[model samples]
Target chain A: MEIQRLSIKSLTITILIVIAGFSVLLSFVSGEYFFKAARESQLYSLNRVIQVATKEIMQQLHDQAYDIATALSIEGEIPKEFVKAVKGETKGELVKALDDPLITGFVGAYIIDLVKVRAYDLKLNFIAESHQGIQGLSPQMPKILYQQGYGRKGVARSKAISGLWQHADKSYYSVLVPIGGIFISGYLEVVVNPVNNLVRLSEKMNSPISIRSGIDPKRFYYEPKKSTEKLLPIEYELKTDLGASAFLLTSYEDIAKLSEGVKETVFNTISVFIGLVLIVLLIAIWLFQLLLFKPVNLMLNEIRNITDGDISRDLQVKGLAEIAILSGEFNKMTKEIRSREEVLTRLSVIDALTKIANRRKFDEVLKNEYLLGCRSGKPLSILMIDIDYFKQFNDTYGHLAGDDCIKKVATALKRSVYRPTDLVARYGGEEFAIILPDTTKSGERVIAEKIMSEIARLNIPHSSSSVDDKITVSIGGYAVVPSIHDDPVFIVAEADKSLYQAKGAGRNQFVLRNEFNSVI
Target chain B: MKKNYLISFIVFLLLVVSGIARAEKPFAPEKLQGTIRVDAEAAAELIVNTPSLLVVDARKEVEYSKGHIQGSVSLLDTEMTLEKLSKHAPDKSTPILFYCNGERCLRSSRAAAKALEWDYKLIYWFRGGWNEWVDKGMPISR
Candidate 1:
């Protein structure tokens, strides 16, 4: 019954595990949603930042182009000797003016004198127009008497003229204006550097972030099993009206990686917490068993063993209210039983008249020995012994003296065979039997003869002239390996036959039955 | 060495202040100064500054010896008569502080509730009692 109360422990463990499982599941679901929302917000914010910065860059380019146009329009004071050397050529004067501070250190700037274009470097060097500079430029730049965009292909292709070549990387812008009544067209360029922009943007974002200047559709990375076709490619365009087009490509993998870190951390922390909870719970359960359940069971077991007939041992338990109570109850119960058994055992399996094992005890012990012999495949021998002329002896000596004589012979019969396994019983009036387990036929005969002789040695006189001059016994013994099919009654009948034969031949002797074939 | 010294000083201060202001109500001494080593002392100092107060003593007859503050009464031997105190200590809102012998003393603290049962509000316990009061000689009367 106390064991039934232990269901509470299992119930508590189940409830805790269920709570933990649900919490982990909820955390995973919420974490997934959080990762999705954070990644999208990060991307949107990065795009906005790039758009704003690029707009500023475009505005600066447009302003520089206007200044170059203004510079080309002005006429510098050329000395007569300088004019003679320049031959009044606009190209020479424009090239000489390229060293001006306005043109120097600028990202993209170009000056055109009639047909020729000169671009200024950060070092203030003026270089003649190369083939590439003449072709590529910002598409937003205005055309002036130049057939560049006038051909009307794609507007971007026609307006593009790359002229301002710097740092071995060319990024160009185009401008057209009138210089001294002559239409001059110039192309300015810059090389787009997204690395610095991306680094700075990442710092501002204060999270994992990236930016790419040129878009390539192939740059997307995805895992096949987790990615579906529904997850479309991310594409955004960067357009400066000056005919520059830069595609923006970003990977969702970066977001995925960040989410993985979070997932791993969360799972690791949960696993550790779960492990700790399990360990603590295990210790609690063990303590409950040790201090509570185990001691209680021990008291119960001691009680069980005492009730089962071992009354010597007592229960010893300490600690815990319930267990202590149980221990006390058990000790009291076993003590009562031991004292009661002291009285009851004397009356158990003992004949009041003969002081030998009674018929009931013989039946119980015979069945037990027979069952044991059947199980163990051992031979058991039984002897059915009857005193000859017992009725006449009772008639002469009176019932009391006859009862006394039977008891005297029964005592002698019991004392003759003294093995612990041997059992002697007063089967009925004047009929006593001995059950010898693990004995062969010859061994049974030898024991039966000894018991017969010991009874004769008691030397009680019998005047009845049927078998012998003195009181005597006729013993019949049968030995067999007991089995399921063999009846104990059949063995007793066979021994009884031998007993009749002994009485017919002469009393005070034992008759042995030879081995017979088993019916089983 | 400086760090260890600072730590030791802090521990010492905490122990000393812990001995005093062991009361629930603010402990406003007749005169007050110095930093508190314990949070409870600081809390008591904050509330006990005003006048018009009731102080209950729950110490035994032998313990009431040595010293006790003026205007304080021993309620330990008195039968539970919360209803009779309405006339002598009329204001239910007046601050009250209760104190007994030492750390093991729960008697005075329990007695403080008698005033509360009578609906005398603002009850407190001075956990330190006479031993701490004599250590710091602010003000005293037999």
Candidate 2:
């Protein structure tokens, strides 16, 4: 491609724009992604809080039930009677033992949320409960435990086999424990209202909580029907040994905190994105300027200078390797152009055939001599020489011979002028002019006569010549000391008039003229 | 290159550890052998009166942890070795009681039988096991 086709300035701008676009896109996409992630993670953590709280509440119930069971087992009277009952003793005594005020009172003192303490037989059949004669819960065992086995939980496992049984709006946390320790006469079901402890659960969490029937809504706003304060709801399931979702423990988290956290997260994400983008943009621009744009612009200016005819200076740029190389190449190109121009200048001042100065150089030197003569009050002279009957010689001999004869005559005329300050030029075809600086009138005549003798000595045959059977030339000379108002062309005109007179006298002759002399 | 070495070293350590573990264990019998199998109440009476009796729970640790009799140290029948048995009851004549999940489970029987082969004396096999213990509502702890 041409050098100007891919301008570095335009390329830099394009690359900068592309980088900016990519950075903006990255920032925007990441901002969106992080915003969603922040919100989702916060909501997820709230759900986690709900899960841990429910587990803790369930764990507390199990621990309390286990402690109560251990206490009852330690009470000798209760276990002793239970053992007898398990050994197939009559149920009347066991009923009496369970209904006793002392036994019931002892259980009541252990827990505050205690709903009831009921006993199940080996077949998990309901027997006698506390003397309060509470009318609740079916007399039959929970079918899940009964159908699985005859209270195998009382023997097989020891985690206080529990289930959450919801009756109306009141949900009870019930634990099934083997009451008589190792012998396990029957299972004791301790039913406690988990809602009362939930008050503490809410207080412990520093949030409000509500128990729904089933855990379906995991992420939702708290019931607007309950309170006016804006709140986010986090929910968890309280599962039972029956492996059923018993209740939804929904904790109302103040939206103010969640929103503040989300806002901070989102703000930080966007700020970081913007910061990264800005840093990237700055770095990219700096690199472009340092490595590409600055150097290219410098090169362009240098090239402009070259185009404006100032090819002397070289392009030097300190930058990236490629840009340095490009500048070096540009400098090399300018050097080539300067050298070629020098060659063209030299060729323009030279005559092609004679290997001497041409007419243009002659006039230029004559004018300069005239000016110098005017300044120094010195004399300047010009000689106009011509070959006599050179056309007849060309008709007789051939054009090649004519050219050879002209070359010889011009060489003789040039050799006769030995002054370093003199200039011999091929004024036109077969005509020559010599410019002499600091030459007086006699000196001019001497140089014109010497040129005639040099041509004669060459002895070049010219049978068609009217003067002699050899090549010869007519010489005309003029000398003048130029003044400030004098034109160099006056010297040229005087020399031409004298040359016409000499050619009129006959060929192979010389004539000299000067403004101060009578030969003019 | 560093990662490769770490992985190889881990694999080598695993191989060496497993090799030593395999080499260290003694053979245990799979089937039940001769032992005096007592009921749960009788076993409880023996344990209550005899402070010298060592109660061995012959169930997997997970099953045992669900709840075993109080003061019973757990060792699965499948994992039993002569060294392990001796560690529990150093005196061959010491009264050693073994129990597992009740009659449906064979861990106690196999353990008791393994003990008999090891020439241990006074091995009481509580065949009714933890099932009968809890079923009878006998005194128990976690």
* Candidates 1 onward: DockQ, in order: 0.00, 0.11
lDDT of 2 by residue, A1-520 (tens): 6766986667777777787778778776876787678778888988887777767867776667666655555355556666676677876666665556334455444443666666776667676666544466666655554554453432353324566665544456666666655445666766666655655557556787776555444433233346835777777777655666666677777767666776677678777877777787788778888888887788788889888989999887888889888888888988999999998987899888887889999988998989999999888888898988889989999899988887887788778989788999999988899998999888888888788789889999889888999888888888888988878898899899888988899868878888865583
Relative to the unseen true structure, what is the C-alpha lDDT of residue B60 in candidate 2, on a scale of 0 to 100? 89
The Cα local distance difference test for each model comes to: 0.57, 0.74
Per residue, candidate 1 scores C-alpha lDDT tens digits across A1-520 of: 4767765547656666676677667666766776677668766765676556544544454444544443333233212212332344454544344333233333343322222244422122222232222345333333222333344321121122322222213223345332221111222222223332333332343333334433342442212334433332333355333434443433222345665776777677667766766677677667877787667667667778777878888888885887788788878877888888876775688888888888888878888888898999999888899988899998988898898889898899888887998988898999998899999887886787788778778988888646777788888888878888877777677777878877887777777774483211
Question: Candidate 2's residue-wise lDDT over B67-120, tens digit each?
Answer: 677678999999999998788788998898998887767778778878888898
DockQ of predicted model 1: 0.00
Where is model 1 more than 4 Å wrong at Cα?
A: A1-313, A319-332, A339-346, A375-377, A517-520, B1-142
Residue A234 CA displacement from its true place in model 1, Å:
83
lDDT of 1 by residue, B1-142 (tens): 9999999999999987876656543433421121111222322342334346565567775666544654566667255365545544677777666666644565654566566566665766665665655443212333
Task: Estimate the lDDT of model 1.
Answer: 0.57
Looking at candidate 2, what is the lDDT of residue A158? 31
Best candidate according to TM-score: 2
The top-ranked prediction according to lDDT is 2
